[model samples]
Target: MNMMVPPPSHSSLYYCFQILLALVLFSLQMLTHQLEASSSKVEVLPGFEGPLPFQLETGYVGLGETDDDMQVFYYFIKSENDPKKDPLMLWLTGGPGCSSFSGLVFQIGPVEFEIKEYNGSVPSLVLRPQSWTKLCSIIFVDLPLGTGFSYAKNLTAHRSDWKLVHHTHQFLRKWLIDHPEFLSNEFYFGADSYSGIPVPAIVQEISNGNEEGLQPSINLQGYLLGNPITTRREKNDQIPYAHGMGLISDELYKSLQKNCKEEYIDVDSRNELCLRDLEYFDECLSGINHFYILDSYCESDSPLWRRSLTHELKKSSSSHLTDTVPELSCRIYSSYLGRKWINNERVRKALHIREGTIGKWVRCYKTDFEYEISDSVEFHANLSKKGYRSLIYSGDHDILVPFMSTQAWIRALNYSIVDDWRLWFANGQVGGYTRTYSNRMTFATVKGSGHMAPEYTPEQCFSMFTKWISNLPL
Candidate 1:
């Protein structure tokens, strides 16, 4: 054997080369994974004239098992002021089914629809001067499932608030894992409307996860809510709110208080007097736009509002009866423009949306989306005890979720008032009133604004937001 081992065999050399090649390929693959973890790039949106004037990245974060088709879609806009150092807000719009794009264009995002004309083509985009992106990086997400560009492999994956909270918690963890660079940035959970019900729960989950030593911790510092629905009892405040605004006579309001016992929601079936008062109350508000009593009621044909018909039946029917009231339907035209713009084939490609994934894009989805957990008032109380910073604002003119109701809940929190109610100045005038609580919670109202504060009072909202987030008085 020692005499002539045939020196070395070509077969052995070939085997060694194969092993080396495999190792090299595996190493390259690992490098690729790392690169993809932070794979955000500048976007070139279709409706916009040139390349996106600001940095925007669109991506999907998978939920549940890899094989499970639950995925959440998101639009991340890097902070124009300082992406690296600025806070990161996870902004969830109301409607529970409203697309994140609604927030993007209508509320806080950098661009808005330039509704100059509607020729059955995609609507042009224009820069929003008061975009929240100027102060903090924003992650606008289509939550739950079946919203915006987000879709689940199975329709059954559509979730209610209970499951939605867990999924959203998982989404935040996974998103941070992929974009680790933002893990250290100050984080806040911002939501409005019905999203108010889930944002607190989601924050609580994140807090619990961090406590359990979860991977990729979130640097959650606080949260933001505007015109939020904090409890099911929110409807109970309508009569009082109506009376305060002088929409109803004192006698009618007193009759309601005596008959309804301040419980408009879930009225006792046996209370005939209460029912009669409610009937009269309904008649009085029939023609008023609950969203903004000052603004004319605008009828919308969008599927979102159509689905919401049941919820708005009382208001709609009332509005219909009052033919004398003025009609200003600008919001309807805006909704039509957005729907057309998003559903375009070219626009889909520009946004990197997968074809056949979503059916139609509406500003807000219908109630077909289930919600298992309804109330999150306790979650808010728990979060308040944790010493987290909070900012809750409402549109003073909004009758939908009246500012008075919001004030009621804040008072219920039992936190001692740190700063007594006072006018918050913006643009050298009184923008709204604000009160600070001992637990770092601040409640402010945007004067002359509606349910969607940012949309109605962008400049004042921006000023208040910038000041509050900067730890300055609003």
Candidate 2:
């Protein structure tokens, strides 16, 4: 028996609605894919004259239980030389508050600010010849939220030390899930300055996660650090380092040793003699540039000086050079140019930065972040026992966290010296000195460089990094 059918007009209407539903679903899927792609896409940057010559992907990795609020921003640059086979390095810039862009544009990234002069417009970017991107793939990250373009929905998400380590470990695991292509690649954790307090723990966390059969295992290899602050107070060898650099007299040094009992930090407030010695010591070191002894201390007008003073103000409610004001140096002026360029709306849009997420893009974001972990020296020692390769480098001229202090901590590890101290050369000139230990650890110095070695000696740093990463002698 044949069933009664609807009229032709009704049948046509039903078919049309079905077709429209299908089309809508397809469009929604496409939109979802496009959004995902856009999150990791960077087509053009404002400062650059033309399209980006190399691959630069900017994105955010969601963190925490829900993976919705805490977003960590990152700039991933594929290796210009060999993206497929080159080792992948997670580069973290120190400050516990410094934006990773400082390392990206100023140190090892593909481009640098062309600050021949500042005309109030966006500072142009020039190709850096010695960028590390030529050798290995790098992910420059703005971590711990509240940094650069990274932010969290809740203000309490701002983390410190161990919490940072945990968050970073989770970030890497999720980041690899997003970009699975590099999951099997040789992975490394690297940082500079205050990162010394957290990097080792981060590495240890990764090692433990991998050992515990965590999802999307990372091919953990080793780590890199430059002028690291291994211990909170002990690593700050300012006075002794000053004496070695001839910034102080032997008499004053002896007085500090005798009165302060060789402990310069956290001295007894009741000891008037110790306080007097430290006062004299402070006076002697007042005019010196702690970051780079050789470089002239650019006065308050300098952006770098202002930034440093801002950090000092945040930490201690005062600054040593508050009364002194002088002319801006060219380097400091160039550094200031980066701030102007990054804060530009056009540049931010081109880089795919989220609107209203960050108010200002400063080199270092000053905040009251109390770190959970006091020190990470034990983490380094534990990592050493794990047989992972490690590189600890210092800028010899840096007084803030001097090479002598780094050496003293390494000595505390009691690792046998595999190779004694020797000069490492680049372009037929003695670039620096290096030493190797039995525990797969190497310590080196960049001669005439400041706290930020690559920023000061890009070519030499590139040479040193390329060789070190390749397991070759520097």
- The lDDT leader among the candidates is 2
Overall local distance difference test of candidate 2:
0.79
The clash number for model 1 is 1
For all predicted structures, in order, the TM-scores are 0.87, 0.88
Among these predicted structures, which one has the highest TM-score?
2
Q: Give the lDDT of residue 369 in candidate 2.
A: 69
Minimal lDDT window, size 10, model 2:
301-310
For model 1, the superposed segments whose C-alpha errors exceed 4 Å read 1-42, 301-329
Per-model C-alpha lDDT, please? Answer: 0.79, 0.79
